[model samples]
Target: MLAIDETAAARAMIQISRVAKTYRTTDGEIPSLRPIDLSIADGEFVVVVGPSGCGKTTLLRMIAGLMPPSEGEIRVGDRIVTSPHSDVGIVFQSALLLPWRTVLANVMMPVEVKGLPREIYQPRAEALLKMAGLGGFETKHPWQLSGGMQQRVAICRALVHDPKILLMDEPFGALDAMTRERMNAELQRIQRETKKTALLITHSIPEAVFLADRIVVLSERPGAIAAIYTVDLPRPRQLDVLGMPEFVRLTTTIRAHFNAQLD
Candidate 1:
């Protein structure tokens, strides 16, 4: 087993050291993120929360190796990430499921694309579907499911390959309030069971406080890590905890950071 220092291990399952991102535009050069030094530990759930144009997604993309940083380095485990790898999985705001594929087919798509044997991954796919509460919906198409259900399938798809790290960008942002809350609860359960290192990007302070072991707040455009607050809340968190004074206190504190950035 990988022994990690719970206290200091925020050193990162994935590390972003002095990273920056720049884009060449028609006008000139545009910088999205500044030098950001951050670490997400093994099996740790970290949320990056910031305003609309805070470059939160840009940071996530860099970590996933979907895009390279203009400067600095990103390391996953001991390897530097320069390109997307099978060990990392990503889910965006949209479920992005194939319309024609059944839930099972979508979940198994990663394995198919990798040219892995179906027999080797079929059982794993089935178990993931069941875990995501889609056991009976395996044969159903993406259009046949509700928004929340579609997102659930998207998550199972991300986890189907047994990735050591999962990068999610506002996966529940599109759902209704109640459904989003339910999905939040389901996500906590899934994280507890899978223990995958996760990095979530969201604009919701409460969501960040509820789902993250640590919340990294970023400043506006050309984003930089403004603050990092450890949740320190007990695990397997009950949704009811959201109503507790402690939860409310933490939420307010995070909100204050965002509010300060605006000023």
Candidate 2:
């Protein structure tokens, strides 16, 4: 059964209670996720990892309120997530920055959409870009930057609106291996500074092990929580942790689950 801590649920910023989904097709009903019960406390960083087709993205979309669960409910800050709310920010695999807009303008897009005063959010946006190491490139267009730089711009855009929760779906998946490592470090620093409650989904065991305060591993399709691990490794983690015994042990344990599937 899925684990639920009553105390954590009481203080959760995001709560998933018996939430599940099934897609109805002409042929039959196709289940995506099994009933899931999880809670993310305010300012906590949680990462979900699963095999291909395990509905990791489906789960994130449900929490974002982009889609609804066929069963149960999702609550954010004690409010039910029946529809997409401004309290959340999302980042996807690709940077998805508009080519025509300058980096600054792209980051300002959310403010524009909500018809908020640019004068007020301008300073905030600039601050976020600078934090992401995109300060000097504000005036440059998306096409002018390298892939990793563009993704940094995307991170800035996601945070510019000052959302309380960040939902990232493989935000670094498109970068080269070396660049992905660097972006992972950058993301950890940003998360620590912002203290925004975050949920990230990735296929990489190392990524999940490195960044998560707690890691949720999902079973293969018709996804359910296979295990949830609390990372005891030290905070402000660095690449050197990859060599540490605890790091290797955790990653190896998580990896073995997928390896078991092929047996």
The prediction achieving the highest TM-score against the true structure is 2
Candidate 2 C-alpha error for residue 89, in Å: 0.6
Worst 10 residues of 2 by lDDT: 1-10
Deviating ranges (above 4 Å) for candidate 1: 1-11
- Model 2 residue 256 CA deviation (Å) reads 0.7
Q: Estimate the TM-score of every prediction.
A: 0.95, 0.97
RMSD to native, candidate 2: 2.0
Which residue pairs overlap in candidate 1's backbone?
12-40, 13-40
Query: Model 2, residue 51: what's the lDDT?
Result: 91
Those runs of model 2 whose alpha carbons end farther than 4 Å from true positions after fitting are 1-6
Q: Backbone clashes in each candidate structure, one number apiece?
A: 2, 0
Best lDDT among the predictions, by candidate number: 2
CA lDDT of every candidate:
0.89, 0.92
Give the Å error, residue 221, model 2.
0.6
Q: Residues 1-263, candidate 2: write the lDDT tens digits.
A: 23546667878999999999998999999999999999899999999999988889999999999999999999999799999988889999999999999999999999999998999999999999989988888899999999999988888888888999999999999888999989999999999999999999998899998999999999989999999999998989998898999999999999998898768
| TM-score for predicted model 2 compared with the true structure | 0.97
